[model samples]
Target: MKKLLFLLLFFPSLIYAQNKTGGINWISWDEVEAKMEKEPRKVMVDVYTDWCGPCKMMNNTTFSDPQVVQYINENYYAIKFNAEGSGEVTFRGTTYKNETYDANKAGRNGTHDLTRAIAPVNGRIAYPTIVYMDEDFGILSPVQGFYKPEQIMPILTFFAENVYKDKTWEEYTKAP
Candidate 1:
C-alpha cells in the first residue's frame, strides 16, 4: 500500500516537471490590436490549422526552444491563430471570420478569412505560415513551412531590429 501511494504521488510530479518548459506567450488577434495601440510592438502570427503536421512539429520544436520563446516574448506580440476556426477577429478596422466553416467536417473545414487575407501566396494558403507585421499592422511577410530554431533565428532578429528596410535577406544573412 505504501509503495502504491508513493508511486501515485511521485508520478504526477515527474510528468509535470517534464512538461513544464518555456514557450511563446500567444495572444488573440483582438488582444494584439488592443495592446499594440497602447504600446506598439511587432506582431508575429502563427497561422496554423489543427490538422497540419508541420504546424504541430514547429510548435513542438521551434516554438518550444527556449531562445526562440524568450526572443519572441520580448520583441513581438505573438498570436497563435487557428486558420480554420470560427472565431471572429477585427484587425485594422475590418472584421474577419470563417463564414463557410463546417464544424462537422473535422479537419477539413473552411479557412478563416483573416488567414486567407494574411497568408495568401499567389492566392493560395499554406499551413504553418508565420506572418510578420510591423508596429502599425502592415504585413512584412508570410513565411511558410516548419523552420528549425537556427533557421528562424535570423528572421526573428531581422524583423525585431527592423533590418528589412535597408538590408536584403541575402545581405542580412551574410553579415557576421
Candidate 2:
C-alpha cells in the first residue's frame, strides 16, 4: 500500500520534470495553417537541409536557448521545414515540390520549389534561412545564415512586435 501511494504521487512529478526543457514547440505547416485559421499568430519557419552544418549548429545552440524557446512559444507558430525533402507544400495559394529529389542520392539533393519562392536571398538560396511571416502568413523576411542566441533575439522581437512596419532593420537595431 505504501509503494502504491508513493508511485501515485511521484509519477506525475516525474512526467512534469521531463516536460520542462529549453526547446521550441515545432509544428507542421498544415497544423500551422489550421491553427491560424481559428486564431492567428506570427510564424517562424526554420528552413534547413540535411547536409547543412550551420543548420545543425543553430538547432543545437540558438534554437535551444531558453529565452528563444520561450519567446517563440509565446508568440509564434514554429515550423521546421526540410528544404530538400520530398513533398508538396502549398503556401500563399501555390503548391511546390522538389522535382530533382533522388532517393538514392546521399549527401546533398535538389532544392524544393518552396525554398526558391520563399527563402531566396537576392535570387540565391542558402540553408538555415529563418523565415518570418506575419499573422496572415505573408512573408516578412527570410533571414539566412546561422546566428547565436543573443544575435537572434532582436530579430525575433522585431518581427513579433511588428516593429518592421515603423522602422527599417538598421533603425530598429540602432535603437536602445
Report lDDT per candidate: 0.90, 0.92
Q: Tell me how many clashing residue pairs each candidate has.
A: 0, 0
How accurate locally is residue 1 in candidate 1, as Cα lDDT from 0 to 100? 100
* Residue pairs that clash (backbone atoms under 3 angstroms), model 2: none
Model 2 residue 6 CA deviation in Å: 21
Q: Write candidate 2's Cα lDDT for 6-65 as tens digits.
A: 999999987656445547889998899999998899999999999999999999888877
Instruction: Quote model 2's TM-score.
Output: 0.87
- State the local distance difference test value for candidate 1: 0.90
Give candidate 1 misplaced runs (Cα > 4 Å).
Answer: 1-21
**Model 1 per-residue lDDT tens digits across residues 1-176:** 99999999999997656545456889987788789889999999999999999999999889988789899999999999999999998988999999999878877689899998999877888999999999998999999889999999999999999999999999999958
Error of 2 at 175 (Å): 5.1
Task: Itemize residue pairs with steric clashes in candidate 1.
Answer: none
- Flag regions of model 2 displaced more than 4 Å: 1-22
